[model samples]
Target chain A: MFRTISNPWISLASRLILAAVFIYASIDKIAHPDLFAEVVHNYRILPIATENLFAMALPWIELGTGVLLLLGLLTRSAALLSAFMLIVFIAAIGAGLWRGIDITCGCFTVSSEGRQLGWLTLLEDVALLLPSFQLLLTAHPGISLDRRYLPASPLSAEPR
Target chain B: MKDWVAAHRGKATIAGAVLIVCVFGSIGLLRNAVAEHPLAWVAKPPVLVKYDRAVRPSPDALQTVTLEDAAGMAFDAGALFVDARTAEEYAAGHIQGAVNLPTNHYDDELPAVAARLEGMTLIVYCDGGACEASLQVARRLLKSGYAPVVVFTGGWPEWQGAGYPTEAGGTPSP
Candidate 1:
């Protein structure tokens, strides 16, 4: 499982998949900042004032990292950030559940994904995390812009 | 954990952290420049109860009213129980004698639910556990002239899960 998935082609596929997800997830949020802000407020996690800020910014962060991952440029950075973000997402949802705060918006996602316990449990969280962790760990993910632009060295090139 | 971090260790992890900070930080800066707003870590809305009731929030009914409190007032003719879940969720099952008035549909539900709740302590609730509908509905009720409403934040699922009386079907039985 590990070797098959870690191959350049598989790693590239994983990176693109994670990228597409983050990109797709961020679109509606960026378009509807107000609704997103209200959703954030509903979690009751952040102060009333900061809700708008997160609403304003999180989608962009997702978009930026997602684009980088999709292009196989900054693959490691993008995937690492993606993994960290998922960890935060899981924690936020978990904390909301623990505190009994009612994080749902309507169907799925608190901030764009996995707002409900059922949604989180039904692979939304883990499915997203798997590729990101793969991207973070796999060296020299293929079809990478980094490989082209940064030139050869184990640090920036094919593994020795 | 250490092993995992060590495997990914290199400039990539450092760069990722920096990029994330820079991007998120830019958001913060832009927000401050274009729009200024207060930032609180998290804010808890108060649970408002009627004046005749003890001014002190019953330990039972802070941001969330306990299941026991919900049951204690379940059948009180004078206490209005409002379910903030979707009509479908209410139909699936809910606290017996609780009226469906989902927060999202507040405007549509207000006139009728409000009329029924006149002069009574309103208990706003939903399916519970991070379900904001209860809080949102409760606040809306407060905004819509219902004062001192209690958020049964423990909500419908909790009430039902505890083996309390429940009712189901298209029409809520309040």
Candidate 2:
């Protein structure tokens, strides 16, 4: 049921979109680390100590994964990681809505976006999930280094 | 083991090992770096239970003032009027000489406010009628040691109805 994008142009487009999302997200968080930390705390998910650590590490993870994905380096690993992080975000947004907590999502906006714990945020995350899933499915597609660096044929059969 | 090592000797294995090391090491180092910066979007400093409880302003601390009371005062030269509404709401219209200090996230912004209005009689208000932002802000200010914080319960709407001096798109007149 999934559309496969084996074409080089399609693959490039997908990679670019994913990379742009990550890069933009990372820069925004990097600018206002403390506010992002508060957003994490508002989720009421992690312990206070770990919240800061996660906040710090997550954006850099995004940045690293984005760069790696853009370069088609370890495409599968990067896509999988991005997908997993998106899932966690969806869950957090869902829980926040269910609990009726009016909190500003530090997702995109630098300042408070007025605590819209609604379906919109959840839907936006789901939309992001689609591209990630696409990348994951076509993890080692022809255009990637996975296909270039690692030969398609078995290495063991090659004569020394 | 010797045969396996000899057969597997290639650039592929080295590249794979290097990639793994780099990814894992980068993750560790990134975690350490983030722990130091503590970005607000990702995580926030813990809200101490004691401080949270202590900081919550008492309801009675806010003194609700009537329009007449506000009008009667001979504009105490040192009195500072604060509009505890959103900037948009304040911009649409507000009591003349009132500064905007929206109540949402007041805890984060109050310290800066306290610094500015030190030793000034602060009058806080929101929209007329049942608006609580003014009272909430007034209580918070009182908690922060702002003396004589008066809440104009009859807010901007009332001030406008009384034909009081009003301004738009600029700082209010004293």
How do all models score by TM-score? 0.60, 0.57
User: Looking at candidate 1, what is the lDDT of residue A112?
Assistant: 29
lDDT of 2 by residue, B14-127 (tens): 443345445644664455565653333333231212112125434444455678767755276777778887777778887777777776556676665565578886878787
Candidate 1, position A98, lDDT: 76
Q: Give the TM-score of candidate 2.
A: 0.57
DockQ of 1: 0.26
Model 1 pairs whose backbones collide: A100-B130, A101-B130, A102-B130, A102-B131, A103-B130, A109-A113, A109-A114, A109-A115, A110-A115
lDDT by residue for model 1 over B2-117, one digit each (tens)? Answer: 35444655764666567775876576446545543433333345444433365645532334467777677766767778888878788898777778887655676777766677
- In candidate 1, what are the lDDT values of residues A1-160, reduced to their tens digit? 7666678887888888888888887777665554466677766678675666676677778878778888777666677788887787777676667776544542133332334554455347667898887776666688888789744433332453
Superposed model 1: Cα runs more than 4 Å off: A1-7, A27-59, A90-108, A111-115, A118-124, A152-160, B1-9, B28-81, B92-99, B104-123, B127-132, B141-167, B172-174
The most accurate candidate by DockQ is: 1
Give one digit per residue, the lDDT tens place, for model 2 in A115-159: 456889899889988777676554234355555664332211111
Runs in model 2 lying further than 4 Å from the true structure: A1-8, A113-117, A139-142, A151-160, B1-86, B89-98, B101-173
Model 1's TM-score against the true structure: 0.60
- Residues forming the 10-long window of minimal summed lDDT in candidate 2 chain B: B45-54
